[model samples]
Target: MDKLHAQRAPGRPKQNEQNIPLQEIILRQAAFLFMENGYEPVTLQQIAKICKVTKASIYYYFENKAELFTASVVFMIQLAHQSTLRYLEEKDDLRTRLEQIAKAKMMHAHVDMETMLREANPHLSEEQFGRIRKAEIDIHISLAKHFQFAMDQGSLRSGDAMFLAHAFSALVMLGSRKHVIEHNTPQEDLPQTVVDLFWDGIATQPQHRK
Candidate 1:
């Protein structure tokens, strides 16, 4: 009986410790599965199996599939926001910073949360969809602030900061596709090439050419 008690006591603490990270693990794995298979095809059972947890365990963290999907979008955007903050802190020139941002976007292209959400739109509530859209807009606003800073520093031409930011983001998004990455453009040179094309078009004069 003493041995049984000891075993049971240890098991509870071990279970608690394991449970602590399960929510995040679920979000990450769910995001990957949703991105890989889209929302319609992915089942809670599949997510539970992949996370080695029961459907009840997932329900403990999220109310339903839509909630889980929304939370996963938030999780991914938060990560990207943190990365953007770190990249913006570097002392590099504007072009270099933009290149790094583009490269980072390329690295994460496989995640494609926006596309996945669009494909799964019918399954999501307006509130859930709005949450994801707001997250994306927040990122765009952050990037626009950076563009405004670059304009002030004369690293880029003076223009509508938000518009420039949108254009730059669109360019990065296009470059992030697998087909674009695998094209004749070498991976190492792609980000730099993208930056050069963007900056050259928006830069002030011949002296701005680099």
Candidate 2:
């Protein structure tokens, strides 16, 4: 990664006073900037400035802008997957757990992942894209396992767990969208509203017979 191109400057120390690796700092900053602005508009210099490091520091870890972009995105996805697992495990009841997960997701403004990936597609190579896809699939599989467990406990209807997981995630994403909420809709109520809608669909119910 260090061999691609060296700009006209004396190299800076790759570690800060706190002993944090320059590569980790660069990835965190780059992830935020790329998610906020998309791949095309974000520049290595911009990330360097935000990270309080020289552009050469970033080049030390990443060969080029495309490589940096890919690494940062994958890092962000892995962090998100870790966070979702923590949230999922916080509550025992499925409804409460889903609400907690939704609220955690809604706590921040989010760029749509699909839209972001589409914007980044032209710059990323196949292997870089594959890494990101695998990270995304990991999160979905984690959620699907929880859904399958709820089904086994008879809390949810017997259906495709993976599909239910995807459906719940989609509903949360839709609820989290800025335009979906009205001025009067309290932010605190949104998670419950989303979970209620989802629960009303696949939750197990008493069978009715004439």
Question: What overall lDDT goes with each candidate model?
Answer: 0.77, 0.81
Spell out the clash pairs found in candidate 2: none
lDDT of 1: 0.77
User: Tens digit of lDDT per residue, candidate 2, span 49-125?
Assistant: 99987777777778789899889989988987888899888766878888888887777545666787898888889
Best by TM-score: 2
lDDT of 1 by residue, 1-210 (tens): 355334332322123355657778888988878766778888899999998877877776677898898888778887887887778778987778888988887766663555787887888899998988888788888889988888898877798998987888777776776424475656877787777778786556766436
Best lDDT goes to which candidate? Answer: 2
User: In order, how many clashes per candidate?
Assistant: 0, 0
Residue runs of model 2 more than 4 Å from their true location after superposition: 1-12, 179-186, 202-210
Supply candidate 2's per-residue lDDT for 140. 91
What candidate 1 gets wrong by more than 4 Å, as runs, is 1-20, 179-186, 202-210
